[model samples]
Target: MTYQAKLIAGGKIVIPAELRKALGFQTGDSLVLEREGDSIVIKTYAQVVREVQKEFRTMVGEGYSVDQFLAERRADWGEE
Candidate 1:
């Protein structure tokens, strides 16, 4: 669904009530704005986190412990 919103003072735009309700957004909810090519994308924080977690779950790699990863990064830093 698409909706048109006018840019208010200070370049702020308000999300339509219907759209917000459909997306289950409350007054205090947070949204993230990201730039993609020539378009700006907006998504709720929860939505972004869910997408990231889903992507992480699908990733496959050699099994490594936190200590191992940290040690490797520290070595790269070279005796900072």
Candidate 2:
């Protein structure tokens, strides 16, 4: 569904309340905006983190353990 939004003063665009409710957005929540070509993509912070994690997992291939990696890094830094 497309909702019309107004660009208020100070270049702030108010997202529609219905859309916000649908997306589970709340007051003072952080949003990530990305410019892809000529379109602006708005995503929640968690959504962006999940996307990054998915990409990282694909790049690292299978059998990658984040806990093990962190332990190794801590060992290198002489930390328990």
Candidate 3:
């Protein structure tokens, strides 16, 4: 779904309501913008959070944990 919006005087572009709803964006929500050559990419904060969560799950599956792993490392480093 594509919609057009006008850029304000100060160069602020308002995201279209339909697109926002489709992407689960709300007022005051954060967004990240990236440039890829001549194209631009925008993503919601929630999407980034979900990606990070997946990465952390993979790390935990690789034998890392908040408490036990840190304690073991500290013991090895003689800081325990």
Return the lDDT, model 3, position 26. Answer: 90
Candidate with more favorable, higher TM-score: 1 or 2 = 2
- Say which candidate scores most in lDDT: 2
Candidate 2, 1-80: lDDT as tens digits: 88999999999999999999999888888899999999999999999999998898898876788897899999999998
What's the count of clashing pairs in each model shown? 0, 0, 0
Candidate 3 accuracy as lDDT:
0.85
Model 2 clashing-pair count? 0
Query: Model 2 — which ten-residue stretch has the worst lDDT?
Result: 59-68
TM-score of predicted structure 1: 0.67
Residue range 1-80, candidate 1, lDDT tens digits: 78988899999989899988998988988999999999888889999999876676567334655677688888999943
- lDDT of candidate 1? 0.83
Q: For residues 1-80, could you state the per-residue lDDT of candidate 3 as single tens digits?
A: 55788979998989888888988889998998879999778888888889887898897785666798789899999998
In order, candidate lDDTs are 0.83, 0.91, 0.85
Name the lDDT value of residue 1 in candidate 2. 81
Clashing pairs in 2: none
Q: After aligning candidate 3 to the native by TM-score, how far in Å is the CA of 27 from where it should be?
A: 0.8
Candidate 2: stretches off by over 4 Å: 61-63, 74-80
